[model samples]
Target chain A: MKTKLIITTGAALLFAAGVLANAQRDAIVASLASQAGVSSFNADAGRAMFLGNFTGGKEATPSCTSCHTNNPQAQGRTRVGKVIEPMAVSRNPERFTDPEKVEKWFRRNCTSVLGRECTAEEKGNFLAFMISQ
Target chain B: MKKLTTLVSAAALTVASLPALGASPWMVENNTTKSECSDCHMAYAPGFLPERSWLAIMNNLSDHFGEDASLGDAARQEISNYLVAVAPKELRGVSSIAVPLRITDLRWFRGEHGSRLRNRAENNPNIGTMSNCTGCHRGAERGFFDDD
Candidate 1:
């Protein structure tokens, strides 16, 4: 009887945590969509952007995959060998929770990989893809 | 009498050289500085450079070593203050006019790491760059770097 009660409580807590994380992600995605004047974000489009190679950016970093790796679920390494946490929402629950951090990385990485700031639509799509992962 | 004097002098020399044999440890104390600066690289010990160098580095975060590492105003100010507070007043062989941006550029660093060791770091895939201090010094995060 005690074991059952403990398990039920643990499961409830886990579900609550998941719901909170999802709510945070939804808010961020919604803000991006409003900025882009879009109804919805496409995860497929985001995946393409993540994998696509571009000529405009620095030669060393042609795609997001150059540093983030093709698999968003796996850990990536920086050019200088620093370990980047997994980008998948499932793998890293804290990914993209902060507005400031999301904006900062997008501004820096988009400039490095795409030679420009990511459009609001692109940012939304990227988040959608990671969420799906 | 001559033998006794020589032995005493040798013991004194060993005592004096003890401090020189071990490198001083420098740990990051500020939580903001540790987390923010360590996002891309290790939050390097502020003592590695002087006050002017820290100020210069903090002022140019947007183009930090060719990457845009710009921080919000509040974070930038906090980190800058912490770094300046703990950095050494003077470093050996560094001139007052010099504002070194890279720790590797310091004369002491160059003397400590020779070309042969540098070549190995460049060539080895496991240790891609010399900036990855933990690649060789396993205890780098804990403020230890004596291991060679």
Candidate 2:
């Protein structure tokens, strides 16, 4: 009986943590959507942007694929050869949890690849695609 | 007997006077600096450069190594302060042109590896670049760079 009670409490705590994580992600998504003035996000656009190559940004990193690689689930290497964690939520459960981190990386990487800050719509689409992955 | 004592003292002093082997291990760390710096590459040991180098790098985040790495003033200032505080005392006089804002550019670094490093870092598939300190120095993250 004691063991059963402990298991139930543990399950409840796990569920609570999952809900909190989802809540954080949802809040960021909502803010991005609002900023973009869009009611919905398209995951397909995000995928294209991630894989697309362009000449606008630095020649070293023409697209997200330069560092992140083609597959979101696979580990990638930085220009300096540091290993990057997989972006896919299924492979790495700890991703996209913090809004500040999400915004910060978007600001830095978008500039690296796109040569400018990513639009709110682009940010939302990127998150949507990543979550789907 | 006096000569023997003098010799012993001289030997001890000589050992103490020798230059340190590598950067001092990080005694203090800031979360912002570690996370931000390591996001793109290895969190380089702050003691690997001088205060002037750190200041220059901190000031020019926008064009960091041909990439955009700009940070807000507050975070940038905080990270710069932490790096400056831990910069190597021995390298305090190293000019920026000599080292060129890169730890690997230090004469000590160049002398340590020479031609052997270029082949391994540039050609070896397993170790792609010299900048990946953790590639060979397995204890890079903890500031223990002894194994290489």
Candidate 3:
């Protein structure tokens, strides 16, 4: 009975931790949405941007899908042929946990894809889409 | 009997020199360098480039090969110092013409690879680029670049 109780408690803790991590990412997205003067995030718009093609950025990588692939849940490849972890929080729970890393990628990838930094609203929407994925 | 013994000794000598052949792999094992560099690409052996090349690459993280690879100041300095220390002696103090930043751009690398490289790029999906060393050298992470 004691061993069974311990195992159940351990499983519950792991589940709670996963929920907490997700909540933390949602809080960041919500905060960014407010900063962008938006009341809600639009995952559809985010998906469009993720798949959108543009001529503004570098010719080699005109869309996020150029490197990230069309499917957020699937593994992606860098231009240098390096493997990138999947972006979907479901597929890669460790992603979006580090605020600094999250921001740095946003700053770099947004400029690479859009030729400029992403607005907070855009980031929030993007995060929403990834979370949904 | 004497000839057979000599032949065996010669074979042993050749085997001993196997690891010495080709590029010397990374000697430094800094976790910070490995995690940061390998995140985007292979944690390339620092010995591949000269100290000057490492310095140039480290200093220009924001524009690293048209990608943003900027690291925190402390982490960047640590990796730079580690790379500089472990760079091959022959590569150190070399003239600018001899110290091209890209490993593929190095004259010796071109000479060594020659036509085989082009054939691999054209035919081998895993070897889509010369930068993908591990495609052929499966033991690349351990600094082993022996032919597959």
Candidate 4:
């Protein structure tokens, strides 16, 4: 009985922690949405960003989902093996505040993923999705 | 007996140089001591690109704009060899699975090329001809385009 109780308690704690983390993510996403002047991240937009093919002529290659999984929870890396964090409202504080690096990565990754420069609206929507996380 | 052994070894060596199709180039690079086509077009998987398209991109690495990415002649040749060996038979964009996708489906990319593509008036521009993806994506490298 004692062992069972212990297991139950542990599971409860883990569940609670998960909820807390999700709440935090929600709050962060809320903040980002306001900044981008959008109310929320559209699931369709995220899907498009994640799954869309590059439309340019430079190369015939992979889509965004090729590395960073369609969702942020599905963390991925570069074809060169660089580690990428989840694109959602990252619990990792480093992601949100690093505007300079954030922009830089968006620029580089957009090219690598899309084989072209992403537009401002696309970037904004992508941010909306990440924030929605 | 020595000749037989040598023949077996040569066969193995030739097979060893082959790049895996339809897999992530990054992870593949980690396992092999050999440099791969992924080292340059770091974003797109081998299967996504037709062999000829890969060759075109690889051949022009030095002129890769956005950042003007450059590759040595040797890397170019080796990558070219790998891609040609693996290029797809069917041209892309013809079927549902065709890559370098059209704008109707890819919302993010559509928005990226939206203005220019829209300006064309008919919304009939071939996604391949617009050059929008290349303006910033910096193809021939192994990753996606970013603003940073």
Comparison by DockQ, 2 against 3, better one: 2
Clashing pairs in 2: none
Against the hidden reference, what TM-scores do the models get? Answer: 0.84, 0.83, 0.81, 0.34
- In CAPRI terms, where does candidate 2 land? medium
lDDT of 4 at A56: 52
- lDDT per residue (tens digit) for residues B1-148 in model 2: 9999999999888766543333244523677887888887878877777677778889988888878888888899888877765675446447645545887776778887687777877686556877877778788778776775
Over B14-129, each residue of candidate 1 has an lDDT whose tens digit, in order, gives 86754333333287777898899888788898888888899999998866776667788999998887776678777778998888889888888889989999999978877878
Tens digits of lDDT, candidate 3, A33-129: 7799988899998899999998766667789998889999999888767788899988998778777788888888887778788999899889889
| Tens digits of lDDT, candidate 4, B1-148 | 9999999999888777666534443222322213432323333344445555565666565445332244445655765665565556455344534443222344444555567654663333222233333334454244454642
Q: Please report how far candidate 4 places residue A7 from its true position, in Å.
A: 24
Q: Could you give the candidate ranking by lDDT, starting with the highest?
A: 1, 2, 3, 4
lDDT of 4 by residue, A73-126 (tens): 666754333456776665443444444445555555666656566665566667
Model 2 accuracy (lDDT, Cα): 0.81
DockQ, all candidates in order = 0.39, 0.53, 0.38, 0.02
Q: Rate the local accuracy (lDDT) of all candidates.
A: 0.86, 0.81, 0.79, 0.53
Stretches of candidate 3 above 4 Å error? A1-10, B1-25, B89-97, B121-123
What does candidate 3's lDDT look like per residue over B80-120, in tens digits? 87776667545634575564679877767777777866686
Ranking by TM-score: 1, 2, 3, 4
